[model samples]
Target chain A: MSLILKGFGKVLKNKEILAPINLTIKVNEIVAIQADMEHMNAFLSLVEGKRSYITNEIMMNEQSLQGCEDLFIYRPDMGEYKRLTPEQCIQFWCDLYKVKINIDNVLALTELTHIRNKKNKHLTFSEKKRLQFARSLVQNTSIFIFQEPTYQLDLQSKQVFNRVLNEILKNGGIVIVFTSSLEEGVRMATKVFRLNSRGLQEVELGDEGEKEAEVKEDETDSLIENDTVYQRKFEKISAKSDDKYILFDPLEIDFVETRERQTILHVNNEEFYSTVSMKEIESKLIPYGFYRCHRSYLVNLQRVREVVVWSKNSYSLTLDKGNEQTVPLSKSRYGELKAFLNW
Target chain B: MNLRLIRVLLLKEIKDLIWNGQVAILFVTSILMILVFFTFNQLEFNLPGHSITMFKGIPTTLSFIVLLVTMYVQGNLMVEEKEQNTERLLGLIKVKYINVFISKAIVTYILSYLLFVLAMVIHGYSFENFITASFFTIPFFLMFLFLGTIIAEASSNTIEVSLYGWPIFIVYFVIEGLIYSSIESRFFYLFPNYHIERGFSLIEHGEFLAVFNYIYVPIIWMFIILFFLKKRRKNSKTILNSGFS
Candidate 1:
């Protein structure tokens, strides 16, 4: 489970772009790493060097299940295919994606045509974020190491990535997917480690998205039904139709449920602003799939389509419609968004 | 994965060598030349020495040409793998690189050697002294066959193997000629082919002994080439050897 990367640090020139410290991984776990192309390439250099600390043998293999004999088929050309062996699948997604470039008359390949260099061009931010989540998964080789495996790929090829990792884990193979997405990491990982400006923080799988949303709605119903101040604020906020967000002081908030959660209403009014607690509203909204990505807002999962960079310091999302709402995407919550988005 | 697999890979390499259109054509042409020489009992040569029995001329002249062509083919075996990404794929396998390299060399040598044997039999039958010529030639043929294989694999692939390996392989005999011509080195039995070729050539020339001596140079060349391969592997970084991210 422990990969001793000898002299790896010396070669990676830019260290500041790396995740915050305070992370630890165990055997047979999934930890996805999401980093820039340069960083991943450096990581690849280490892996190919038999840096895995395994024996010199490195077979490009897939699964070997009894019923699933022809587990994965790799297309080396448009119509040509090569079978994936048992070992390749238990490891990762490289088998399906990479096309091994070779020479015509000899075994030596051109150094210039190396595969790592080829991945650099044409990547969207979302794809890069997705990779960060994948990296975190790969690091979790602590709990589940892939046994003899195979790939079950469909057209477009990426559909089998998660299924393959899951099978490997089912048989017991550790996976670390270095990613930058919250949705991808959360979906694949049992336990996850995320990089925050506060340092490395770990998040336990809290609850299912639908169930959590339902719970929050029930809390909001109770607070609006019972509390005198909350009812007045709700009335006042409901009266003010056009205001996007109501300013509520934190000290005035009365959280009857989950401790650290906060709520920000999209209405500005004195009555509702004074009576309704941020935490109470958040707790109430939880049942509706509203999770706090920042201190000031509770985002509805169904409404959010994408987190696009608005500027250097902030990002905005064009929700379900043309609703252009800018929200602060913090480094602490960066990994979470990726997992939540499932990208 | 096992000895059986290794044997299969070895046989496959030999099959590849034997089936190659270029190698086959070169081999066939060498035999045809030998057949032509035997038909005329000798080609019109003004360079040196008498036009003795064509049976005697083959082990030297025809063997050198075939050895050169075979080595040329051997040197390019890995080139195709590099071009096709086969080496990277095969490198992932549990097999040893040395095993693959040696297997290819052995296969190339065997094919070249077999071609030489074919030419010998063809020439012997034409001369009407097949029994006597065949008797003296088999042992020498075996020795040269093994040596020719070694030399082909022994040289560096930077320049073409045929250009470098063949000339150097044949030069060992030419050096023997320079020494054998001198009274100072009348006891030139050191060259494996020198004595065998000379032994038969004195009474009646036969090219078999000279071909046998030609094999020694290549045998020594194989060991030398193996040494260089060992040095390269030893010097490279582990990252340099296999996967590079």
Candidate 2:
């Protein structure tokens, strides 16, 4: 399941806010948003689920494991609310030691409350920066871009953000933070993408600043390298969010990746409750009955419930869930769903 | 609720509320002044057209809540984002700014009215006859809030929005006073005060007030203000800079 972000850019309409003219940040890359007060809302519009002053009303309603993925970016009074204390951290670590919970689950902090207010509440500048950094670390998704992740933060918080950002990169993720001060950006980012008068450009960093991206000692790397299980688990790996992970486990996860003519079926969690890929689906369930319905979707020849006419020239596919999911019935697949499902 | 973003925005608002604590103090003081119209120094619900008087106070509280909070709170919305240069940050993450706005209004209302209610309670006022059923003032409250937010968003000078909010206050007061004096007139219908009258009349008659402010003045004015702000963003390249209030 390879997801691609085609074209994304940000343009500032104010002289008060000078941005790197135009830039494209892929998924999983941590890209920092840097600007003064005027551009904050515009930058905020990028992540908000609703229409904002910066952009149009397009929204991505998917759930992200990154803590507080749905939170508005510019709330100022957030500190006045509440937070889980340092003591809470001790308690959490104790629980983790006891349960041996996966780091991913713990990082999500699903039950997080009071710590994040639905409305704006009071917070110090440092607190906000720290939280943003933590969010970057916990998000196990495609590319991250932090726009000035270290602005107005106190010293300790800046250090913490820097550490968390490095951790994100070390975890097989990409991160890019924006800064007017090249020194700051150079210090913080691993892969710096500059968006000055020139369209978007990229720059790789040398060893400098916080070394959080490193695995601390040679032991950690050797532990994984020497472990036969870990080696066998990862073969040909590609990009991943929470939903789509490439074939990492060598033996059990054999796949053929090519831009080929073979029909590839996509199984998304939204309409496709059946988590099996088209090949797996074709083997055990819908044998002799699957086709690449669309570029981003698949259909089981045996389970399609209906083909509702979409327009004079197109149609939609309804499935076992009694839910209708659309697929362009290009003059090609019109007769496929019905004859295949035998309905 | 992302703790980071919320913390950033919330901190700024508190800084603002405190910086302009004078507005809050003045607004509350005005409410205290209205306590003069009380039937007696002591608490009593006895008076001819008692419902009428009580009905009017409902919108008054809402409008004042909207007015004063707007005076101090409107600038706190997307203003800082416009200033600190982070709106595009918000856009990139795909945040819901309206929720931020609504949440901000809610917090402001809760804090302001918490104090207002405490003042009322301290003075032996009773919630028993409060606007339990009438919702007329709700639209008026929302209209004021949305319109005020729009003005704050579009203001040329950021400092003037908070320091000299009297212009906004004066316009609202004049409109409210005229509408209040002629509740029966069609002119007041546009004032949101008219809706307050209707809602209060129903509450006085013991009817259900609506639950959706989204359907009332709040919703209408919210869309109106949002439209203008969006329009301004499109019409002028400097629109985003002007929003830094």
Candidate 3:
């Protein structure tokens, strides 16, 4: 089933929550929407059958929201409330949806087989999230609306969630992910929409050059050459400190970390402080071979030597230079970093 | 209209009550309260050479018991679903809200009636009195069950429901008692159980038509409560839409 929002506008108490939005989503398409937390929640509320638009059209499978079977499945992010074990919860969902039981496959897929007998309330946040996903897999739902599915989850558990998302997409399900993080939008979506006070707008991913159309003789060849030229331009970045400045090779920097709101540049044997915030530095350096490994640390992709999993959810990245300088890696961004490294 | 779904929901309610030990608590308390009140009434009023009327004190005791059990069971059901946020799960399908509401009312009514009859049996009321009195009293108790549902839906948690439900329930009886002695206003006719004892007295004397004036008051209260519930449901939906607490 496909979803189409045509001039969809939502208003609450004389204040417009969502301006007129025009978008069409196809089956198997994973659309991630990034916005302020409040607006994001309002949009999710509409999607999950909690609210309806005041003056617009929303159609799922060519039908309105009311009595639409195609919009049957909506799982809000709620804490575990059932007194039953995870295994029983999965079975109950299967029975409720009148689907066949595939408990073993669900347990194995979520890596929750070991804790299958534990009551839902006793499970950790990630475990409970996995149990919810397992329950969803047992039911036959055409569209999956996930509100902060990765919230408060470790990187490894996020990959488990990512796998579940991929499985849903593979089965031609509509996946709508709502988050407040732009990194999450880049990580999960092929297309992203931004909701702000001004209204909804499409967010273009990748280089500004890619967004423009070139009327060259060879359009395909020109596109390839343009990408390579864009890549060559970001080989190095300059920084300033104490009335002195340096045009340093970005590859020579092992990592850039933020401490106490100060952005510190980390080289092999030298450190330079920048007045710019980490977010400012990140935007300038991301086009280069730099990857944000954690909220505090951004590493030069060429300097990363090894990916280490110290524990189930704890991880670190070892740099190739400076006696194998170690940098803390966030679990939330670990999978994206590994994918960027192709490791 | 889906009988199977209604059956499934009713069973779920019963299972939840049983698992939570509410049913057992209500059952044992009802029997014990009956025994205590039975003995107390006999000793206080059944003096030497004087005949004690079984019906004298039964209505008041049963009314209080109905209030307690309805708030306990129906209130628990309402707050539990809202607390756990499982109410939305039911809305996932095409089930009518009316069906859901009626199903809960049916289950709660049956449980409350069972408690009443069990207490009546232990109090040693005659079968003839039991049959006729229950026929008139069931509607009055059903009104209480509906009010209990409104209390449950209006409140957020178990503690909040009980804290609010109990005071209003007790105050209702107090007002009714005051009205019975001091007021002859028609506004008192708006109450569900008003003139219930008088209606029963008329029934005992075979004055059947006079009972309609008493019974019709509860019918009006039912419609009024249902109207209020429908409006509250709309308000809750609006609150949900706004995504505010």
The lDDT of each candidate is 0.41, 0.44, 0.67
Show model 3 residue runs off by greater than 4 Å. A11-16, A48-56, A59-69, A72-123, A154-157, A198-297, A300-343, B1-4, B21-28, B45-57, B92-95, B125-130, B175-195, B198-214, B234-245
Candidate 2 residue lDDT tens string, B55-80? 25544654565666644555544354
Deviation (Å) of B143 in candidate 1: 12
Q: Is the docking of candidate 1 incorrect, acceptable, medium or high quality?
A: incorrect
Task: Give fnat, all candidates.
Answer: 0.00, 0.03, 0.10
Best by DockQ: 3
Model 3: lDDT of residue A330: 61
Runs in model 2 deviating more than 4 A are A1-135, A146-162, A177-343, B1-31, B34-66, B70-89, B109-133, B155-160, B163-165, B175-245
RMSD of each: 14.9, 23.7, 8.4
Two-chain DockQ for model 3? 0.17
Indicate the residue-level lDDT of A90 in model 1.
16
Q: Looking at model 2 chain B, which ten-residue stretch has the lowest summed lDDT?
A: B236-245
Off by over 4 Å in 1: A1-30, A47-156, A160-163, A177-343, B1-5, B11-56, B60-69, B89-94, B125-245
- Considering lDDT, where higher is better, how would the candidates rank from best to worst? 3, 2, 1
